[model samples]
Structures are given as C-alpha cells and as structure tokens.
Target: MEFKMKTEGFHIELPYGRLDISGNEENGFRPYQLLISSLAVCSGGILRTILTKMRLKVDDIRIIADAERNPKIANRIEKVSLHFKIKGSHLSDEKIAKALELTTKNCAMVQSMIDSIEVCKTYEIIDS
Candidate 1:
C-alpha cells in the first residue's frame, strides 16, 4: 500500500483503485468507512469460498454492514454487525449457520479483530 499526501488529504493507491481519503466528508472516503467496507467484503469473499467448497451454488451474496464507534476514548470501533443475504436454491438455515460459523472463524480480517471487536453475524437465505 502506497499513500501520497495531496493538497486536500491523501491518495492511497490500492490494487482496486486510488482511494482518496480526506477529512472533508463530502470530498473523499473516510478512514473508518474503509475499514468497515473491507471487513464486509473480506467476509463475503471468505463465505463464497466456503460455499463453493461445499458444492453449494449461490446466485448472489449481499453483506450489509454497520458499526458502532466511540469517539470519546480514541475513536474506537466497538462492534460490527454483518447481515448476510444469500440468494440461491435449496439453501437451509442450518447450512448457512454452519457456513457462517466457519466464516467467522476463518476470515482473516474477522480473526484479527475477533478478540477486540464484537463481530455479530445474521443471515437470510433467499431461494432463487
């Protein structure tokens, strides 16, 4: 990861694209927003891998993520809840529960912060 300081804030060059982060709320991505999005997508990818290995076909996976932050004590992220919507066929709540259990255990980002942050997961399986 390479970061260059710009007049407005900073430009971080990543594999996907250049991430412009600034204090200006309307101008660029906030640092905390990046962490929240990364956590969601990282978990999403991990879940997809697990499902494929289990021979389950899925049409789409939507990860809706939100976080609670405390600014009084160093602006820490207290908790993150991820609501997963999996669109597929013949999917059962039992299967998803197992998959999510593994996802929480295996996702690198989740594992990194599991001790510090409350990572809660819920799911809905939509038959397609």
Candidate 2:
C-alpha cells in the first residue's frame, strides 16, 4: 500500500475507498484508533466464526475496545481491553469463555501484539 501525503495527513487508496491517517483527529483517522480497531475487529470476527462453528444461533455481536496509551513513551499503546456484547440463543457462560479463549489463541492480530501489547477480553451474552 502506498501512502500519499496530503495537506494535513497521508491518504492511502484501497480497493474499497481512500483512508486518511493523521496524528490529529480532525485531519483524519488517528493511528492509534486504526491499530486498536484492527485488533478488535480481528478478534471479534474470529469469535463470531467460532460461535457459528459451535452451532450457536447468533443474532449480533458488538465489540468495544479501550486502549491505554503511555505518554512517557512516545504515546505508545500499553494495553487494550475488549468488551463483547453478544446477542444470541442457547449461549452459556462456559461456552462463551471457551470461545473467547480460542479467539485469543487464533487471532492473528492478537498473536502479533502478544509480545508488546497486553490484551484483555470480556463478554456479555444478551438474549435474542
């Protein structure tokens, strides 16, 4: 991917559309936002797939990510907390926990950040 410099930030042309990235939020999407979003979506997608494979009827899945950044160290991300709100049928706490474990183990984004970023996951099951 090539990033072309704009007046305020850099923009990359993807197949779907253009993505603008910048340090300032008003200019474009922040780098940290994209990083956390990538990790959150990757794990969420994996968890959804795992639940489907387990034959759980899923209506929807929503993931919320909270990232802790250390200002002392170039504002680097230290940890990420992910909360998943899942609306489904026949879901048990035990099964959801196991599915989350599997998701953490298998998610490429989580694996990639294992050495540097601390990732924590929690979930709530909503009746659908």
Candidate 3:
C-alpha cells in the first residue's frame, strides 16, 4: 500500500482513495473518516470477542456508522454516531449492555477517539 500527502494543500492520496490530510474545511471526507471507521471496527471486534467468551449465540451483527462534520475554516469532524443492531437469542439485556459497554471501553479506536472528541452510540436487540 502506498500513501502520499501534499505539503501545501490539505489532501492525501492512498493506494485506494484520497483524503484531505490538511483537514480541508471546504472539501469532503478528511482524515477523520479513517479514524471513525477505526472505531467501528474496533467496537465490533471487541463485542465479537466478548460474546464468544460468554458463549452467546449471535445470529447476526451489524453496525451503521455516521459522522457530523464542522464546516469551518480548518474543518474537523465534531461528532460521530454509531447505531448497532444485534441479533442473538437467549441473552439477557443486562449482559448485552455490559458487553457493549466493555466494547466501548476496550476498543482502542473508540477509546482514542473518545478522548479527543464526542462519540454517540445506540443499540437495538433483535430476537433471532
């Protein structure tokens, strides 16, 4: 994989895509997208690990991610929102909530992002 960043402009190019390295306030999808995705994957990974340890049977798991950007001169991502839908049976609400909490706490991506910015999360439990 190759990566390149412009010194003058706030743009960066990756092997697959280009990003605004300088936090382009005028453009879209700055470096923050990568950070946000990191959180999503991290949380998912953590939850998977915890559930496996607890032997909870999961039918399906999906995470929907979105972010709110601040369109100012050095535009930055201000807020990140996560919506999670979990499909599992024979699991208590408390156990699921605990797993979610632990996932947020342990996920390095979420943990790092939360320290510098605000991240919101909501979950839905589905019987399957």
Candidate 4:
C-alpha cells in the first residue's frame, strides 16, 4: 500500500497503507497537533491492549495530552506531557507502572520522536 502527499512542488509517499491524511498548516489539526496526536494514539492504543492482555479490568481510560509549543518558530512543539487517568476497581500501582513503561517503550510514534522530544507521563487512579 502506498499513500502520496503533493502540494506546491513538494511530494512524499507513505508506504504504511493507502490511508492518506493530508492537511495544511492552517487546518484545525495543525502539523504539530498531528504529531502529538500520533504519539497519543500510539501510547493509548498500546496501553489499552496491554492492560487487557494483563487481565486488568478497565472501566474507562482517558489520556490527556499537553505540549509546550514554541510560537516563535512555526509553532513547533518542544515538550509533551501525557496524563493518563485509568478508572477501575482494585487497580495496582505496580501494574500501572509496568503498563506505562511498556507503552513508552512500544509506542512507535513516541519512539520515533525520542531524539527531539520529551515525553512525560502522570498516572492517576479515578473512581468509577
């Protein structure tokens, strides 16, 4: 599968799938938001799967993503922080820590930006 993006004499092909997503710098989801979105989705997906695989009951999972964007330079994100609120019964801190570690290690989007990005996580246990 191949996806293509072409605009104003620039073109790039993505080989992941035919699923193509294209937007300009002015769109609702700016280029920086897209990057953050990718990271959030990757981590969230992995976390959900890992929790389920570990037989942990999840009542609800919410991930709040925040980033510090440098408005001076094309609105680029300098640092990212993710607050994960997992609501369930009898959840263990050890398990949550392991899940966070696993998600950080396995998330492709986060790993890709490891060189130029700072990812922080805060876990919270909420009552359902």
lDDT of each residue in 1-128, candidate 3, tens digit only: 34454554455566777655445645555566667888787888899899889899988889899988778845677788888888999877888888888888888888777766688878888998
lDDT of 1 by residue, 1-128 (tens): 66899888799887888889987867688887888887898899999999988889899999899999999978899999999999998888888899999998888898888788888899999989
Candidate 3 segments exceeding 4 Å error: 5-30
In order, the Cα lDDT scores of the candidates are 0.89, 0.96, 0.78, 0.81
TM-score of 2: 0.97
Candidate 2 all-Cα RMSD: 0.7
Cα lDDT tens digits, model 4, 1-128, are: 44344552223345652332445553233456668888888998999999999998889888899999889987778899998999987789999999999999999999999988899988998766
Model 4 scores a TM of 0.76
Residue-pair clashes per prediction, in order, are 0, 0, 0, 0
| Full ranking by TM-score | 2, 1, 4, 3
Clashing pairs in 1: none
Candidate 1: count of backbone clashes, pairs at least 3 residues apart or interchain: 0
Query: Per-residue lDDT for 116 in model 1?
Result: 88
Runs of candidate 4 exceeding 4 Å displacement: 1-28
TM-score head-to-head 3 vs 4, winner: 4
Candidate 4 clashes: the total is: 0
> Per-residue error at 51 for model 2, in Å?
0.5
